[model samples]
Target: MRILEGAGTYVATTSNHWEEHLEVPDLSCGTYSLPAGGTDPQSPHTEDEIYLVTHGRATLWTPSGSAPMGPGDVAFVPAGEEHRFIDIVEDFAVVVVFGPAEYSRAESDTD
Candidate 1:
């Protein structure tokens, strides 16, 4: 088991996203921080994911549509879907969970 103290510490080190494995092999999680007006540079992933907003506000855009997001909001993106956070009104932080653990950019190219 692993315990992380203080989201601020994680937020400080994570410029984009910092991912870590969970106890279960099929699940993984991470935190990302985007300064106001910043954008998420990553593309889509090979595994489904859920984003839990921890701070700030922005609009999550996908091909299907767009929606406003803020603290405590949750968003989901299916595998291979194009999405990004735009028009960041404040410093944004979110916890991302990926299914089939290790399903991030580091592992996507391997498949």
Candidate 2:
């Protein structure tokens, strides 16, 4: 059992295209603030991904095509689908959830 305060681990900054915070296994949840016109090319994922917009707007570019998403918008990318995000506003922040628990990235202990 664990608890994460999004406001703590999450932050917006330059030089870093985005920030990733592993809240827990099978659930690498975090917030992202993509600079305007920034784009992340297609990437592979071992499991399904859910992206929920917390602020600003973005355009998702999948193999199928591009779709606009904004605050209160949620997008689900099926497993194995090649997808990326583009045309993001500087004020954008999104929460992501990767399911099946087992597929979540293993955490490293720091003692």
Candidate 3:
């Protein structure tokens, strides 16, 4: 088993919405945080993902629609779907999980 601490420090140093922490052959996990007015500058991934909100509030938008999100909310996004958080009312933070191992952003960008 592995243990990770210092979430606040981790969040403080993160420069993007997502900061990967664990990567195994079949899955990956990361901390995602965005301050108010911040935007996610990433494209849709090739792997399915789950987001567990831990702090703040925002609206999650996908190709289908948008919905309000806050603490304790869990969101799921299928592979190749367009999505992002908009109108961040506070510093939003979440734990994100990706299945089927390491989702390469470079590869996704090329596709």
Candidate 4:
């Protein structure tokens, strides 16, 4: 077993947008952050994803429409679906989980 010890602190202090903490064959866990007015540069992923918002407020935009999210809210995005965070009203911090590991399905996607 492994531990991320102080994941929130690391994520909050990191300079990068995504700070990955743990990974195995089927799952990967990390933290995703965006400051108010920051751009969401992420695109669709090869694996399914879930985001647990631990701080701040934002609008989650998908091809279908948009929804507001904030502290304690959770989100799930199926693989290959287009989605992004927009209109960030406060600093956002989220715990991200990916199934089958992030980017792990990219190679198989060709088939």
Candidate 5:
């Protein structure tokens, strides 16, 4: 099995807003963060995604509806669904997991 030490520290120090920490054929994991009141710039992913909030507060919005979020909150978005985090109430951070690994579908699409 693989091990990652200081994963949180690395994510906090990363240059980008998101950091991918692990990946394999079936799944991937990463950390995503945003400042208070920041806009989410992501489009829908090609693979299903799950988010486990570790810090701050926000709202998860989708075509179906929306729900308030905060530390320890969890959310899931299916592939190709329109969704985003909005009304961020504080500096937010979440651990994200993707099925079939993120971008794996994008590669197949280009073929």
Candidate 6:
């Protein structure tokens, strides 16, 4: 078995956020952290995504609505729903799981 040190390997940027690949099995699982005012590109997902906030606060913006998310908050984004994260605080960290997890994610512009 292997251990992942989340604090050391976390990527940071001024614009888009960073994601470190911990493990992507049939179900994708990893820890994601978003810096203050960071925003992500909009895209349609092939699998459902569950975000469990473990730190700070954030707001998930979708075509449907904007909702506040903080520590202990959980958000489930259904497949095919175009969505993105916004209004991130400096310590926003969450564990994300993408179910079915068959789809591959590339660092391409999902505009």
After superposition, candidate 3 runs with Cα above 4 Å error? 7-17, 104-111
How do all models score by TM-score? Answer: 0.79, 0.71, 0.83, 0.87, 0.86, 0.72
Off by over 4 Å in 6: 1-12, 17-25, 102-111
lDDT of 5 at 60: 93
Candidate 1 lDDT, 17-67, residue by residue in tens: 564535266777777788786768878888888888888888999989999
**lDDT tens digits, residue span 20-108, model 5:** 88999999988888778688878999999999888888899999999998888888999999998899777788888999899988756
Instruction: Quantify all predictions' global Cα lDDT against the true fold.
Output: 0.75, 0.65, 0.77, 0.84, 0.82, 0.71
TM-score, model 1 to reference: 0.79
* Model 4 worst lDDT window (10 residues): 7-16
Of 2 and 5, the candidate ahead on TM-score is 5
Worst lDDT window (10 residues) for model 3?
Answer: 6-15
Deviation from native of the Cα of residue 107 in model 2, angstroms: 16
Clashing pairs in 6: none
The lDDT of model 1 is 0.75
At residue 104, candidate 5 shows an lDDT of: 88
Q: Rate residue 35 of model 4 by lDDT.
A: 83
Candidate 2 lDDT over 19-99, as tens digits, reads 556645545665556655666654767667888887677788887899998877889997767887787765566777666
Q: Who wins the TM-score comparison?
A: 4
| Candidate 4 lDDT score at position 58 | 91
Clashes of 1: 1
lDDT of 6 by residue, 12-41 (tens): 555544454554556766677667777667
Candidate 2: misplaced stretches above 4 Å?
1-3, 7-10, 15-26, 101-111
Error of 6 at 98 (Å): 0.6
lDDT of 4 by residue, 1-111 (tens): 677764543244323388889888999998888888778889999999998888888999999989999988999999999999999888888888999899888976558
What lDDT score is found at residue 74 in candidate 3? 94
